[model samples]
Target chain A: MTAALIWIFLPFTAAIGLWAWSRHPAQSTRLATLLCLFLATTAWLIPIGKVLRLGPLTLEIQPILLLAGRRLNLTDTDRPLLIFFFTIAAFWFAGAQQAGSHRLFIPYGLAIVSFLVAAMAVEPLLYSALMIEIAVLLSVPLLFPPGERSVGPGLLRYLIFQTLAMPFILLAGWALDGVQANPTDTNLIALASLFLSLGFAFWLAIFPFYTWVPLLAGETHPYAVGFLYLLLSTTSLLLGVEFINAYGWLRNAPQLYLFLRWMGAIMVITAGIWSAFQHNVGRLFGYALIIETGFSLLAISLNSRLGVEIFTMLFLPRVIGFGLWALSSSILLQAGRSMEFQQLERVAEKWPFASTGLIVACLSLAGLPLLAHFPVRLVLLEQVARQSPLLAVWVLGGNIGFLMSTFRLLAVVTGGYFGPRQPGERPLQITLLSIGALSLVIIGLLPRLFLPMFTGLLSAFTRLP
Target chain B: MTLANLLLLPLLLVTISTLIILISQNWRYSVLALALQYVGVFWLINGLWPLGLAVVKLVAGWMACAVLSASQPAADVREEQTSPTAPAFRLLAAALALALVVSVEPSVEARIPVNRFILMGGLLLISVGWLHLGITTRPIRVIIGLLTVLSGFEILYAAVETSILIAGLQAAVTLGLALVGAYLIAAPTMEETP
Candidate 1:
């Protein structure tokens, strides 16, 4: 089997097999965790396109496979990215065992991950638009799984916006055809810029386009939405970088970079302000994600290697921070029927570990000191401060929205000093929560340990390197 | 009317029907209009692909409408009841949509080598589709709007590039949109929750 096909088929086939095996959520969960871990390990360890022998069986895994006349190419440089994708998948899949969701969470989750990987690998790469649309479609069932089904406003909005992005990207690719050779083609440049920005804006859920984020988080299961949100943003970021690398004019466009910065600041401030008033923890998590995107956009706006480094480094913290946050929310959801602030009054006493996980995850996402996200946030804000102190101050000020929620989440869980304390928390919850918390602190204190892994990421895109 | 306007019959049908679906509350009329819109799209796709491909476009669109129709409840108020101002709003949007298409179609026709009616049809569908999506909160209407928007892009793209790969991709996208609509239609209502 070719490298590309194997990566795509493993999850795609597993999704079908696991679903057919038994629509039981528990079995699907176990298989999904195992499959994700195996994929992650393979992605990390195996050399792409290397020939292998197992007695009489000889396998030469070609890096590219053609499907319907289009090439699906898997390169050596893609290994790190593939590893990142699978590892993040494994994290979510493993966490899914405790995070209450539909039976399809495991199966559909794998399929979505596979589709996203295929999107990154597909050549003529505009085809990635189709792949993303397919992934978005797969997300629909997850949003309104079997039995409990609300005609979620979030789901419809998500579908409409995501579908809208596909044509813009595809047409932009067509428009960019000869523009490189003809840089003087002002009209083409303008068209490409407009389409690409609109496409990315919808894909990344930037600003006003991001209403679906909080809405979905408020209504649907947190784990599923979190996974989809993180996957879409990461893939979109990769595509954005690819655009910069491909178009010399776009690569050099300082105006676009400034626009990204201004927009990033706005997203940060807006999401922050909204997060501050959110009474729903689920919506709070959604706003934190927007804050993360804003910071990421800010990093890109720097238009320098430092910016690229910070952005690349974000892959790690983003996965861990969001994973922890989603996992905790899902756990708490299982503990209680609802997470409305009043509903959560002192419920943390019964689910101590979940509450603790929720607090740490929120703080981690908020870029609090001594958490997974702090190191990157610190460096990024410092860089911003160096370029424009007001921007730095603005970003810091926006984070206060998350900070305010953190305090509120803590208060809601604690229920004042007079509240009664419950007995022991669940063993499994305790273990996962402890691991998440410890990892966040370790990564926070030792960002260097993980930062090096991402340093090699841009090298994969040699155009930028 | 000029030859372009003569050729614009199918497009005009598509634009008028798209507006009907957007403003009308009856699920039955909306489905009929949606199917007709797809038929209009199929006709416009001519000269770009084989007769077989155009048939595929028509069939896929019809199937999407069928899926959505099957999922709807009998005697459903899938969208809000029409207000007097709604039609006025739609009329204003129709005018704006017309302006949007007129302003861009010429530049598009000049820059890209495409049939004039095809260009205008695609732009008109896209403009009206966006307006439809923007104004509605109902899931079914939203789905129809999405289908319309995609139809415009697909029609334009088929003209620009007609590979089997592109055709297959677009077909899958249609199916995906249909499935989402079906899912949303069958989902338990929000009012069911306390």
Candidate 2:
């Protein structure tokens, strides 16, 4: 058995099967959650290319699966990636039904996860662009859903920017090949770098291109958008890290890291400032994610072992914060049928768990003390401060803007005349939100225990500092 | 036809079809133009890729056109109504795109070994396609614009890469884009949000 077959193709087939069963969303959710958890467990336990003894039967799972003259390779190092992807998949899927996500979400979400895994597993990683494009297309239905009256410009723009990124990345791959052939060719190197930057900028939705993030967030179900952003952001960030690790020139270029630092700071500042003015909780969710992405970029900008470690560590808090935010916002949106701050009066008094979840998520994203993002954000900002105190202040200014928005939300949710509460939030939702909020604080307080686990992620990028 | 004129045929087809797609409001006409544009793409790619592989682009493009065409009659009611000046505006935009393509062609050509006609055709389609996106908020038009952009990139990339895997994956992406476009058009008509 090949590791690629087990980790990539098997789940893809299961996703297709699950689509047939998506008519029963609850059952499909359960099945998908179990399948993803099982996959994650296998990734954690099994070693690719190593002998395994099952009683009298001995077996070795190969790393490569060949299809139509191409390869899907998953080595022992890749097991960490598999574990991460499937674990995140399980996390999202487990909460999907409770969040009132669309019925098709379970099946299509699994398909997206499978495609992203294929993107990671594919040889000549440039092909991941096409894989990501397929995933983006799959996400359209999730965003638009059925019976939606009128399509939003945000969704269309999301599709456009993502699709546009594909060609530039593919073309960049070809140029990099040229660079490989003629290492000292300055022109080829410059062209390749430009293409890669533009491609990733669109994919990651850096500053100017990020207009779609808030738009899509405002229009779609928060649960689906959360899943979409979480998977896309994580995959793109890993892919960017892989590029740096693979290319000596990219890693060695001080300009690339400098560009990353400035862009990271810029994204954080812009997203944070925008968040401060937003009255919509859903839009706030989008801005919060943008700030997280900005911090991730800053982490990479540090260009050291600590930087890479912080980058990976950021994911745990992000997943919990975003997950809680998406779930709580979804529950609240379903209750009120609107995400506008003015419309959701006394929401905290009405549904305390969901409201607290929202507040905790925003605070965590703002890097509040004793929240999930604090320790890593502290170290990253310290490193950035050491390099350039001015950039660190700008980043802090962005965080302050975001914190203002969070405070605004806190005020809105806490005040307003009390109305009769209707049996509060669902039990499952309360359980999930409570667990998620607790995890954030726990991770923040005991950073050493949870943060080191992400260090395993750095194993996949051995060449990085 | 002389060899020079024959080689230029694809570029002419591509330029005209891209302009037609940009200017035409009729979904049918735009779809037809898109198919013709793909024919031009296939022809340009034939010079670089094997005939068998080049056919994949035509087939995928035609399939995408078919998917999009099948989705339109119900969505016809929602199509944007353009002013009389809109077509002229689009033409002016196309003209600007052509100028940009002409100016950048030399620099682009310098960095890689590519046919001059092919390079011009690719750049023109991408430029016009982006113009199409800039002008339209409608899902179908944006998708067509994206397809055009991808087709343009494919023509240039065909010169640099020849892996069947890339070709197949690109074809799949084309079909996926079309399917998603069709879904967006038909989404409002479904019974409930799924």
Candidate 3:
């Protein structure tokens, strides 16, 4: 319990310290990075299984706090969830170190981690909206580092949409509370469901609400963009899961399930189509994430234990793969003069390892066979097909769109024929690329290795149903 | 009412004050508005004494306001030379404020504690201010607007009584973020017209 608390709080504490230290020009970036690593590792190493006990009482650390007349019990399932969160935090720290992100990265990364943990731990759902808003606000410094040119409109658009989503979520949580008090209140349940779906729709940046993703991609530093997308996408997916887990009524609602499925399918198809035409690599990544989110929604829409299992399994590989992709793209953009495809046409010749990493990562994202995404996609498709073939077709169409986009990206990277490599690239780039490529290959080759672990995690949640 | 409701009062006040700052046309009044707003918030939190840390935040905010006011150059002298629509704008703002207050009343149940009412009113005000600030082109107004929003959120933090430690931390963060905003305003972006 102490460890968990420290894990969550240390980042926030360090952020303030680093922000103060940042004013000093002589400050060592290495010291900040080492400190972040230590804190992140400590968080990752804490054992999550045992419930803390004191005398006759037991306590569980969770994202939600339920205050029922002095009886404070966290939800039972949040233990494993915390473990997952800490693990991701560790990976983010590693990525930050490898990328040599700006000086603000250390503090900003810590702040984001703290915010995400708080978002996960907050109770009653309404607080999640507020927490997410705080996360967005914190993200601005990361997105538009000091000395960068005019701030991207994407940040503003992101703020507006996210803020717009908050009221709906808060209102829904309040309405859900009313329904929970009176279990058979269909009217309250209906209102809660509508508000929640609408809120999530906005939060996920699905379909019509997705302009910010691409716009943000256009303006953001690749590494910052990567972190933002990962945090938002994964957290939103978890929130969707938590929403279902918390409200049994909504989970059982057939109409709600149908709505999620249809929306997911629509989002997948449209985002995929849009992605096929994107020339900018960052926007391409954004569209791909939008499609991936659609897949997650499809999994939830299935309303089955296996569906949830597939979703859980999908997270790790996607995070690793997407992080690699984002980091590589960031390096490419920094080294290359422009983000346009025409400029990137000879990227393979210029940066061979990075080009390979980008290609592999894109392939993994497209769920090509043998990549980490393959097995998850297969399971997701099977589940969808079993329920409805039309839905399956929609998902496949999205997959095809992802495939087309990847090919476009690949074509640009390879420049039609691989040429001689450029010299004087940093050794760090080589190391980052090799690790990313090796991990993708290993995970793709042995999907079963991680699949069972995720399946086990999913079972814990499914048992409640 | 519950202690939860009582704690929420400060949060509401801060929010309302922020909104007032955002929409207030005269830059000079915005700082005064924010100061008065923070005072109300501090008083409300001080009354509850939910967490020992609230005192620190209240003090920090007071100090920040003082420093900011001292450091800032007088409101653009050019504004006085260029415009005479201040009264009409103030009148329009007052009308909007009235509508906002009226609109929020239906949402607030009578059972809610009086302190919570004040807090809620403040939050609404701050949110309005933030919206006003975000839309406006004037750099000073934007900073004031953002600060008002932060203060409103800080007030909301008071109501979250269970996690006193987290609330205090959140308040500190709000102050830091506000300072950053102020810094941005003070050092105008290259894109902004001089």
Candidate 4:
């Protein structure tokens, strides 16, 4: 058996099966969640290229699955990525039932995750662009589920921007071939870099290209959109690092990291400034996501080992914050609230657990003290400060702007209500929110303990540093 | 006819088809223009790839059109109207895009070696398709625009890369985009979510 078969193909098969069974939403989601958990556990436990002995029968999982002149290779180093994608998939699928998402959510979610893994594992990583496009296409129905009356411009723009990236990356790959043959060709280098930059910019939704983020969030189910953005950004960021790591010229180019620093700072400040003025919690969450992405870029742009570590460390808090925020937002949405600050006034009185979840998620993302994002964000800013204090100040200004919005959200939700307080959230949702809120605090208080677990993620990019 | 003349026909075909798709308000004509554009794409690709491989683009493109035509709701047919001046403005934009392509074709060719006709056709479709995307908000039109843009890229890319896996995957993406377009069109008619 190959690692690709187990991790990539198996989940894909299960996704197909789940699609057929999706009419039974409850059973399908339960099975999907369990399946993803099992995959996650296997990814965590079983080492690829190692033998497993089952009472006189020994089996080895190979790294490569050869298919029609191409390969989907997942080595021992790929275990962490498998675990990361599947664990998040499990987390999201587990909440599908309570979120009142589309019935196809679990099935399509599994398929999308499988495609993303395929994007990573596929040989000649340029194919990853096409795989990502497929994932984007699969997400369309999830975002605009069949029967929904309005087709938001956000989804359409998302589709167009992502689709446009494929040709650029593919063309970039072709140019890189020329550079590989003649590494000193400056024109080739310039061409390859331009196409690659444009490709990733579209994928990452960098500024001037990020208008769709808020629009999609405002229109779609918060839970599903959250999952899509989280998965896309994580994969895109890693893909980008992989590209830099694979090419010596790219890694050595001083201008690349310089560009990243400016772009990262711009995304941070712009998203933060926009978030401060936003009325819709959904849109605010979108801006928060953009800020998180911006910080991730800043971490990588630091171009030091410490910066890379901070980048890797940021993932845990990001997932926690977005997950909690999405769950809270979904709960409020299913309750028929519009997610506007005006509509959310006194919401804490009705659904205290969800309200608190939303508040904590936002504050944590804003890098509040003793919150999940604070330590890494603090280090990231300090490194930026050492590089250029003015850049650090700009990053800080952005964070402060987002923090102001979070405080405003807190005020909106916590305002006066005369009625006797009664919990509107279901017990299961309450339990989930409580767990998520506590996780944010726990991870925040002891980041060193929890964050180190994800260090293995960098081991795959051996050449990056 | 000389090989150059043979190639020029398909080039002209794609240019005219894309222009028609851009200017036509009728979905039927737009769809027809798209199918013809794929035929032009196939003709251009056949120069580089085996006839068998080139046929995939044609078949997939036609199937994409079929899916889109079948799935478009009646409401969309009624609502696909545009201002009387929009097409005229689009036609002017197409002419400008063509002028830009003609002026820049040599430099682009220098950057990545390909035939002049293929380059011109690819650039024209890409430019017009991009303009189509910018001007339209409807899902069907957006998909058509994206398909046009991709079709342009594929024509140029076929001259450079010839991996069968990429070919198959690209075809799959074309069909997948079509299916998504259909889904977006039909989404409103389904029963409301619980």
Best by DockQ: 2
lDDT of each: 0.83, 0.90, 0.67, 0.90
- Arrange candidates, best TM-score first: 4, 2, 1, 3
Which interface RMSD values do the candidates have, in the order shown?
A: 4.5, 1.2, 7.2, 1.0
* Residue-level lDDT tens digits of model 2 in A1-465: 999788878888988999999889999999999999999999888889999999999989999898888888889999989999999999999999889899999889999999999888887889999999999999988888888898887898899999999998998898888888899999989999999999999999987899999988998899999999999999999999999999998899999999999999999999999999999988888888888899999999999989999999999999888999999998997786489999776788789899899999999999999998999999999999999999999999999999999999998988955566764798888899999999999999999999889889888899999
Q: What lDDT tens digits, residue by residue, belong to model 1 across residues A104-220?
A: 777788889899999988988788989999998988776777666557688778888898999999988887775776889998899889988999999999978999889888988
The local lDDT score (0 to 100) that residue B68 gets in candidate 3 is 59
Q: Which digits, one per residue and each the tens of the lDDT, describe model 3 over residues A85-187?
A: 5566556555664454666766776677777767776655567776776787677777777666555567656755665566567667767877889988776
CAPRI-style class, candidate 2: high
Q: Which candidate model has the greater TM-score, 1 or 4? A: 4
The digit string of per-residue lDDT tens for model 3 on B75-101 reads 553323334675457546655755676
Worst 10 residues of 4 chain B by lDDT: B72-81
Clash totals, every prediction: 1, 0, 32, 1
Candidate 4: which stretches are off by over 4 Å? A417-419, B1-5, B74-78
CAPRI grade of model 3: incorrect
In terms of DockQ, which candidate is stronger, 1 or 4? 4
User: Please, what is the TM-score per model?
Assistant: 0.95, 0.98, 0.76, 0.98
What's the CA RMSD for each of the models? 2.6, 1.5, 6.6, 1.3
